[model samples]
Target: MQAGCTGCRSKADTFDIAMAFQPIVDAETGRPFAYEALVRGSNGEGAYDVLSQVTPENRYAFDQQCRVTAIELAVAAGIIDTGARLSINFLPNAVYSPVACIQLTLKTARATGFPPDRLIFEFTENEEMADTSHVKTIVETYRKMGFATAIDDFGAGHAGLGLLAKFQTDLIKLDMDLIRGVDTSLPRRMIIESVVRLCENLGITVIAEGIETVAEYEALRAIGVRYIQGYLLARPGFRTLPEITLPGGSIAAAA
Candidate 1:
């Protein structure tokens, strides 16, 4: 179904599906680790599109499909078990929908025999949130329902530490920019270190995103960042879990 770009024009029916991988490490070991699921789309012309364009009304539908497809693919490949968590992104507006995306997620988990705790919803930082009070209520509600919540691209936008304080997030993914020059910039390292300390004090886990080099990985590890995701680890693809291994002989499928 084609949707109007502006006004009421129609668009294409095909939505592309591509996967991006983010490493989820063992909090204690700081190792190359389990991969999180990312969804992407391609227009019929072969250009990749930003997921944000999908209307909030349709965002959950698209993302939930990706989650289910990823899980089914993993299961058919005999990789991921019902025990593994599948992290998916959700737009803020989805939170306001009467059928909140969280409910769809819980349903998917139940149908697949995946524990609710095994599903993590990563909300983007770019969208304008509806109401902080309502957002926090939804987040806490999800947590109480056994699902984990994370603020994607945490340090990249105005959300900053304020959102961290407001929401009881289970994970905070550091922006890629912070991870890129971390090995050389003392100030950057120090900033991340302080955030790490703050998150630690709050009992929230920190993840360093876009680590494309050994230097970056080691630098993040040194600063107490436990999780890392980047090209150096593994690129996102359709393969099942446990099929890929990390630098230390750790398997992504094992997660």
Candidate 2:
């Protein structure tokens, strides 16, 4: 964290951010396991448009606001009654103190009636984490506090196997690059199949993301990947939850 990152960062925080949600659904059952809150502008802008405003000075505030916004908007979008969990993407570098930074999220959760246990804090492995120890601490602390922690873009990032060996997060979404052409690539299939078994042995749930074609989805299912997230299922809905399109031309509510 930088110099301006202290406490709630209420004074330095100035940007406005909104959320878009997409479901991570069970492959076989077509039931939503969780809905990931993706950052967007107030008027349904793309993530890059919103993330461009985040700077080192206000990074902490942005991260804090993201959590609160995600929870509040998700509840308003009717996630409260659904059994599905809420997965929030977080910035590890922006967190100075785990407990202090999460206070606003806790407050928002309490206010919105979102159960703390139903939230999953996700950080991408693509981010160049300066300190692995800090990330490990954050993950352990969050899990102990009843919040699930996940590492996103697992296989394609700054750290791969080494990071996984250390964190062993509750969930991991195999990178889309690894998933994109798996149905046609034998090596891709071999690697993903192997990773699935590894995750099963390690007690980490594997989510095959960025699934596009029927061949890709079928290939993943054959490899035994249970949770799937991508356009083949549903696209991220701005300020709402998009309905999932299951295989065989059937549609299912994301909730």
Candidate 3:
């Protein structure tokens, strides 16, 4: 697992970026299970505005800075008060050395007094893996370091059942494509239910993401997706924790 934590030129590139946090709520309790840190331009531009600046020469810097920024911003947003975990997206290809790259994150967590265990590092399946073995090493090393790992956008892009055959993460977020109209689409409902059951059997939790309406939320809850994220709960809070809207038509502010 730790074998791939080598060969890297740690460098920093000059660029401006920030984070917007969106909550992932618990279906049963209507409380935030975690807050996912999304990349944004310093002036509050969307991810594309920031990602467009990434090049092979600066990918490492962007990835490193993202981790540091997410931790600092989440702590500032009072995540500790909510007792919810902080989930940050990472680019596997950019990670030249998982162990080496995480040193700054560990340092930042310590500086902010954030519990290491409350941090989850997730990689999206949308990003194709040039080396599956490298990604697996990163995941295993992260878990061993007591940080939870997740596969984002499961069942979309290059991420699907085939990838799961190699290894399983702590959580998998169902792609919005599958959850878009789950309430009315029988095919989607069946697919979601099957995925939920498969995750259960594999001891991995499932989170239905990109939900937009009451109907979508209700259907996901019925399908046993305990962790939910999307517009229905709350939009991304720029430099603040947004309030969560419960299934019963009540808003619970993140503390």
lDDT of each: 0.63, 0.89, 0.88
State the weakest 10-residue window (summed lDDT) of model 1.
1-10
Best prediction by lDDT: 2
Which digits, one per residue and each the tens of the lDDT, describe model 2 over residues 21-93? Answer: 9999998789889999999988888899988888866777788889989999999999977789999999998
TM-score of 1: 0.79
| Cα RMSD (angstroms) for every candidate in the order listed | 5.3, 1.5, 2.3
Report the Cα lDDT for candidate 2: 0.89
Tens digits of per-residue lDDT for model 1, 170-231: 88888888777899999999999999998899888887777777788788888877776666
Most TM-score-accurate candidate: 2
Tens-place lDDT digits, model 3, residues 91-198: 899886777888989999999999999999999999989998889998999999999999999989885998898988999999999899899999999999999999
Candidate 1 local distance difference test against the native? 0.63
Task: Provide the global lDDT of candidate 3 against the true structure.
Answer: 0.88
Show the lowest summed lDDT stretch of 10 residues, model 3.
1-10
Using TM-score as the yardstick, the better of models 1 and 2 is 2
- Which wins on lDDT, candidate 2 or candidate 3? 2
